[model samples]
Target: MASTDAPPLDANRYRQDFPILSSVLHGDQPLVYLDNAATTQRPRCVIEKIVEVYERQYANVHRGIHWLSDQSTDLFEEAREKTRRFINAPLREEVIFTTGATGAINLVARSWGDANLQAGDEILVTEMEHHSNLVPWHQLAERSGCRVKFIPITDEGRLDLEQLPALLTEKTKLVAFTAVSNVLGTINPVVEIVEQAHQAGALALVDAAQSAPHGRNDVQAWNADFVAFSGHKMLAPSGVGILYGRASLLDAMPPFLGGGSMIHRVTMDGFEPAELPAKFEAGTPPIVSAIGLGAAIDYLEDIGVDNIHHYAQMLTQQAHDVLEEVGGVRFFGPPPAEKAGIVSFTLEGIHAHDVAQILDQYGVAIRAGHHCAMPLHKRLGVAASNRASFYFYNTPEEIDALADGLRAAKRVFRR
Candidate 1:
């Protein structure tokens, strides 16, 4: 039997690292933050890293020979190395910086998809995809004359893996899916999906925006051809994200944007693009946020990713068990064993936004509405749902508070 015991963690100690967690809201009630899936609060270390870069070493990277520029450039490249190590990418140059996961997906769609996909080629995605993952492919298909298809999810909110074999075929050029669903909390079987995609001669691109924070996104283990995730989703600042592509494949693709440092030489007519990562990262990159992301990576490593994953799983199971006992709660996705530390559900008669607003009165914060997964919400037969997502810094007490808040919302709505 699988172990039910959760690994021990000093969540209070971890909570102290995030200064914003100390804030009291809605009168004197302590804040109960359950929205880490949107963006995690930054720790002191990550905040300090951002401040350090701006206060001490801020400069445009890659062009200047002065000391400040040299220092800033070194730190910027070091962050790339940090990201490469964070996701276990095979090579440092394989990690390309972008605006966010949305930008990263667009990069892959425009550069690789445009170059490789033919008129009749098909790109396979999941119905559970966030708009970031789905829209880019749709746009790509519209431009390149390729078809976009979806892998259906079961009633339980898990991908119907039995259909994978039939869905994957010679005409399928790529299979783009999320490693974890932002709405359903479903953790897809990445290794199985990647292997199947490869067997069918299709590349795999994993949208790891949700899973990256929980720390199980190992590109080497999954053998994914491309992966995209946001640093902000993993406790760093916003406006920075990563795209990890196989070095050889990245080298072969055309550049997504043309400008500045991404080029080797600029003629009056055409310019030759730079190599590997720089080829994709055009203009001035998000230097300060990248450095902060590096610090965030360092902070997570110090806590041990495996430990965080276990604690988050425990929290998910605890919340799931408690919410299941609530009278009107209807949960989405598989059980905690197959999901991340996320619980999306609906209360019997209350609207999702109203539930969230009531929870806010109790100082509990959660996400509501389509959560950028309108297709998945449509599949689940609901226009919106309430989502309480957890992280290592979250506590059982907060989950309890969430349950209390839910009951309170129900009582208010029942009146």
Candidate 2:
């Protein structure tokens, strides 16, 4: 259900802000870009913000007494504050800037996992997790001799939550899972899972790469130990992401990377790590990209994330209806009402790559693969599928265009 508060989303009006949405592909065809689950197109505002930083205020953040450095440092920290507010994180110090969600998860797996986890400890992730969420845990397990267990997904592409009770025991040190499946579009109940993890004495980490751009993620309400999301997936530039850790937990964990800006003092004996955020940040952070993320957050808040969520769901429902009429289509995951704006499907007698090629000729761009969830593909008994993921800027017309493109692909393959 849509949140009751926000005003209705005017997708058409907002589309103008995203300059790339008006591009002409294949020389003549209007571009219908729907690969949002991978990464979203940035608005003009975010783009300009990046340029502004580089042009006027480009300097390495922290420890510089000069004006340029001070300007850059302020912008960088201000971005962190913006991220904290956006996710409703309890403190600005809790927010750390990293390369992307992968970096964030690895930070946790290395720092916290090394300090807290030991041999025989368990980490529970779901079968539907993107590789970024799964691989780190596997690596951590390999390093710490901790066991990695998966929460199985139903045939309907949802986590079989009933098994959680059995899986989450005292031995489980962490429960790391995706907020939404990149391929399946299944929106896992973050709050419910986090609560269960807590009850079992395991800290919960949310991979919000798929969910953050579409809706509000109140970290406080979820009460998760850590939350990670990429700026690129939410209409900002790449090379920047947020990691929100609980204040108490962050205070206890060791630094993941040690270098310049991360140490308070250096000596012949040893070095003391800097405070929260900086301790994990290490080296020069993505100064411009982080500022761009702040601008993107501003743009989202102005339009209201709730409105974006409702609009994307509506577009997703429309996609499901239109694709059904295209014939020879098999959809994955739950119905659109129960999921995000991602629809993964396969066509009869046509390979996913072939379908994707035909769609591209029509200037319709969609992802066609396991979408970094190879294990999920193995579970679903398919090699890969064509995915059309929507965002707030997507329209009903675009969904219809996707259907028409699919029909074209079918006719071509039949020939």
Candidate 3:
């Protein structure tokens, strides 16, 4: 449960923190940014931190004894600590830095899949996963002689949890799925999924790319074996993401990349891997981006995640009601309060690309396409759809802008 009585988020004050939001995209109209599912605008605090790191302390981390290198290394490790605490992980050693969510999931599949999976083993995933979550496992199955299984999704976009009992078995090696569907905005029951996976002697990996932006994520509470998310979607810079694995699991998994910092000792015969996180993080990590992520986390903490969740729910509910009244729009997702801030819908007799273009002309930005979940779209029997995803900084007025844009799109395309 989340607290609703918290004071209003001071949107005006918070809006000031993101300077780019004030900039005009078409030189006249304000940018009604609804494409948060793709990437979020960075706050001034995060930008400042990135600039500060490069200007004040720019050096290669982990090998130099000089002052600048030492300082950079300290700041980078501090960022890792911030990530661990943000997710409520029991140990900082469990956090591994990667390029983004996609890279992190690939790391898991490559390392753990190679080490543990044998011929005829099965990996279970869901239909609502982003391509990042699905492709790696598919590739792993191809290479490791493993098979992939999918959990079906209902027409309303919820996972058919009742089917899980039959899906899990002793041969199941891993169960990887998204915490929330990026396109449908479906919030999966992660705890129940984890419990079911463990019951069958399988590990669980959660793709938290969509959930982390709108709410608090406690890896311990979910008891997930591994969780991955992107920083850019959570108000930080692009090119940096996190992978949180239980310390023991990460300790046993082999290194994903073989290079510089991940080696404790190099021999002519072989190279010994470094400790827990370093073992997985090869080469020079994204130092400045990690610092930016730390600042972004601090900014979110100041605003309070609970308030962000409430604000998003209010916005989505308002849009749902308006879109329902419009009569031709069909929305996909869990009911308003039960999901994240994303809303995906398709209008009858209107192509998604045309609708998006018309919306852009009105200074309203929304995502339009398969949203990287092509299987889910195919399951839903639609070629594509338009999505309007919200964040803490978005206002109710923007929702009205989206509605007006949709109405205009309908009129323009009604030939």
For 151-191, candidate 3 gives per-residue lDDT tens digits of 99987789998899899988998999999899988888899
Runs of candidate 1 exceeding 4 Å displacement: 1-7
Model 2, range 1-415, lDDT digits (tens) per residue?
2234443677788899999999999799999999999999999999999999999999989978999999999998888889999999988999999999999999999999989888999999999999999999999988999999999999999999999999988899999999999999999999999999999999999999999998889999999999999999999899999899998999899888989988999999999998877898888888899999999999999999988888888888888888888989999999898788899999988989999999999999999988999999999999989999999888778899999999999899883
Quote the positional error of residue 383 for candidate 2 in Å. Answer: 0.4
Better of 1 and 3 by lDDT: 1
lDDT of 1 at 194: 98
CA lDDT of every candidate = 0.92, 0.92, 0.90
Per-candidate TM equals 0.98, 0.97, 0.97
Q: Count the backbone clashes (under 3 Å) in each candidate.
A: 0, 0, 0
Best-to-worst TM-score order: 1, 2, 3
lDDT of 1 by residue, 256-327 (tens): 998888999889999999987889989999989998889999999999888888888888888888887777
- RMSD after Cα superposition, model 2: 2.1
Candidate 3: worst 10 consecutive residues by lDDT?
1-10
Per-residue lDDT value at 170 in model 1? 96
Ten residues in sequence with the least summed lDDT for candidate 2: 1-10
Which has the better lDDT: candidate 2, or candidate 3?
2
